[model samples]
Target: MKNVILTQEAPAAIGPYSQAIEANGMIYTSGQLPIDPATGEMPKDVEAQAEQSLKNVFAILKEAGVDGSNVIKTTVFIKDMGDFPKINKVYETFFTESYPARSCVEVARLPKDALVEIEVIASNNKTNIK
Candidate 1:
């Protein structure tokens, strides 16, 4: 069976998609924008944008009983490649020394024209991810 992951700590999905879904032993999260769940606002800078995006991704993982350590892979989308270094600095604060595999690409634009967006695939370590 498939389990839907939802959390108020993360921003709500803007389209017809769940925040994340878990099946078997894996949890796949939708691309998370930088919009803050509480303020419904996106930060202006790339560093803050990356932080917010990761926060959203983690919130979904938290709902599914997982965390960054359980993440096997990640895909990041950014509006400008030049902002990569700044984003990386913020991203590193969220993970440990042994980081999950990641791929980041420069995109022309994001959903809210935000500077960054992120998504993750994590392993559900517990028996029940309710």
Candidate 2:
């Protein structure tokens, strides 16, 4: 059975979508904008935006009973390629033990004009150390 994941620790979905969904021991998260759940505001800088985005993604993962090490893949969208270095630095802090396959791209725009957005797919299994 599929399960819809929700948590107050993360920002509410801006549209008609669950924060994440889990099935068959896999968890898939929707792209997370840098909006803070408490403030409902996006951070002004790319580095901060990246961190917020990761925090949001991990919050959903946590709700699905997993952690960063469980992530198998990641997709990051950025408003500018020039800020990749800054974003990468912040992204490094989140995934400590193992790195997941990742794809990052520059986009013309993003929801709420966020500087960075992130989403992840994770393994929700016993070996993942939730």
Candidate 3:
């Protein structure tokens, strides 16, 4: 069975979609932008935006009873590839030694004109439990 996950800790979905969903012991999160759930504002810089986006993703994971270490795969979308290094710096802090598989790409644009966004898939398996 599948369960829909929602939390005010993360930004509200702007459309007809859940923030994340859990099914068969796994959690799938939607693309997270830099909007601060508390303030409903987007950070100005790419680095700050990246940090906010990661935090948003983590909030969803926490809402689903998981963490960054539980994540198995992730997809990062940036408006400019040149910002990869900056984003990576903040992104690396979230995970430990065995980092999750990830794909980072520069897209033409992103929702809300945010500089960066992230989506993650995490597992609730024994091996990944913290």
Candidate 4:
């Protein structure tokens, strides 16, 4: 079975897609930008932007009934490679020892010209409960 997840805690999708989809025990989330859900404003600095992006990802995860620890993989897109260290610092604060696999890449540009965007995949850990 496939389930679509949505939450007001995260910014509403600006296009035609759900925030996340849960299927067969896994949750796949859309790329999350730094838009603050409360104000719909992007943060100015990379660190703050990264933090907000992760918070958006977390909100989608929570709507799927999962948490950060459940994340199996993540992909980060940054407009500039120079901001990797700053983004990594904030990203690291979210996960612990069993960190999820990740890939970070620099793109020429992104929707809304945002500095960073993050997308994630998580599993329920419960094989029989999907």
**Model 3, residue 56: what's the lDDT?**
96
Predict model 4's lDDT versus the native: 0.91
lDDT of each: 0.89, 0.90, 0.92, 0.91
Write the residue-wise lDDT of candidate 3 on 1-130 in tens digits: 8899999999999999999999999999999999999999999999999999999999999888878879999999999999999999999888888899999999998998999999999996635654
Model 3 stretches astray by more than 4 angstroms: 126-130
Task: Please provide, for model 1 over 1-130, each residue's C-alpha lDDT reduced to its tens digit, 9 standing for 90 to 100.
Answer: 9989999999999999999999998999999999999999888878888999999999898888877888888999989899889998998999886688999999988897888989998889854222
lDDT of candidate 2 vs native? 0.90
> Which candidate model has the greater lDDT, 1 or 2?
2
- Model 3 worst lDDT window (10 residues): 121-130
Ordering by lDDT: 3, 4, 2, 1
Measured against the true structure, the TM-scores of the candidates, in listed sequence, are 0.94, 0.95, 0.95, 0.94
Task: Give the Cα error of residue 76 in candidate 3, in Å.
Answer: 0.2
RMSD of each: 3.0, 1.6, 1.4, 2.6
Count clashes in each candidate, considering only residues at least 3 apart in sequence or on different chains.
Answer: 0, 0, 0, 0
Candidate no. 3 TM-score:
0.95
TM-score of 4: 0.94
